[model samples]
Target: MLIAFNKPYGVLCQFTDESTGPARPTLATFIDVPGVYPAGRLDLDSEGLLLLTDDGRLQARIADPRYKAPKTYLVQVEGEPDEDALAALRRGVRLKDGMTLPAQVERIEAPDLWPRNPPVRFRKSVPDCWLKLILREGRNRQVRRMTAAVGHPTLRLVRWRIGDWTLEGIAPGEWREVPV
Candidate 1:
């Protein structure tokens, strides 16, 4: 079984919370599918498409970086990026982990997206722009860090697609099982 979950911001990716702090929302609250586990993770601060599967081989194919599955994100950054910044992203930016693989990036119009609870802050002086970034490698906070390194800190981040799956009709906090 394959499941695509539109994970909401501030929600934990895992089914259970291991932290000792006050409880936060988790996948268990939304997903009731037995034996299915998240194929990959989206940070607590980020939102959008998350894939889960009950099949181990399918899970590995989705999560493993070796598969080079394209993951697309719609990023709202603080400043407008010129061609130079876009080129830098395309060429690959050096992160603490190492140089990132060249990414597919382009400036795009703001996506029609669901409203985020505790919405991203608004700024009058600092103009923001939207970017569509596609990456094959899954690194922790890589997209956020990459944008920040290029002088445009991300204001809001949404993973729009993973592999061939997308958040097309799914609303935040909604999950739908799809045929594998």
Candidate 2:
């Protein structure tokens, strides 16, 4: 079974009671169908589409770095970006680990999208804008770190697409089973 779940912000990726305390829910509660695991992950603070599957091989294909699947995000940054900053993101920025591969970065206006439950901070002087970043990597906090490195700190990070899958119209915490 291939389940495309719209993971809510602040929820752990796995079906682990170990990490989540009393109130926190895992994939176990949402997906009653057994033998499935998440293909990759959405950080606790991130809200987006997550693919889950019962077939281990299919899961590997989606999640594995060797496959080079492009994951796209709508990132809210702290300022009205200058072209230079966008260029740096396109060229690639160096982090503590190393330099990231070049990404497809574009500036966009914030849409009339659904508001996050606990909305991001408001800095009146610092206007925010959206960025579409498509990358073939899954490094820890990569998008957030990269934006900050380019001098535009990230305010919100939402993964809208992963390879051919997308969050689309699926509401937070909803899931749909699609074919392989």
Among all candidates shown, the one with the greatest lDDT: 1
lDDT of 1 by residue, 50-84 (tens): 99999999999999999999999999999999999
lDDT (Cα atoms) of all candidates against the true structure? 0.95, 0.87
Error of 1 at 87 (Å): 0.4
Clashing pairs in 2: none
TM-score of each candidate structure, all chains considered together? 0.98, 0.94
Deviation from native of the Cα of residue 80 in model 2, angstroms? 1.8
**lDDT per residue (tens digit) for residues 41-106 in model 2:** 888788888999989999999999899999999999998779999998899899999999899999
In model 2, the number of clashes is 0
Candidate 1 error regions (>4 Å): none
- RMSD of candidate 2 to the truth, in angstroms, is 1.5
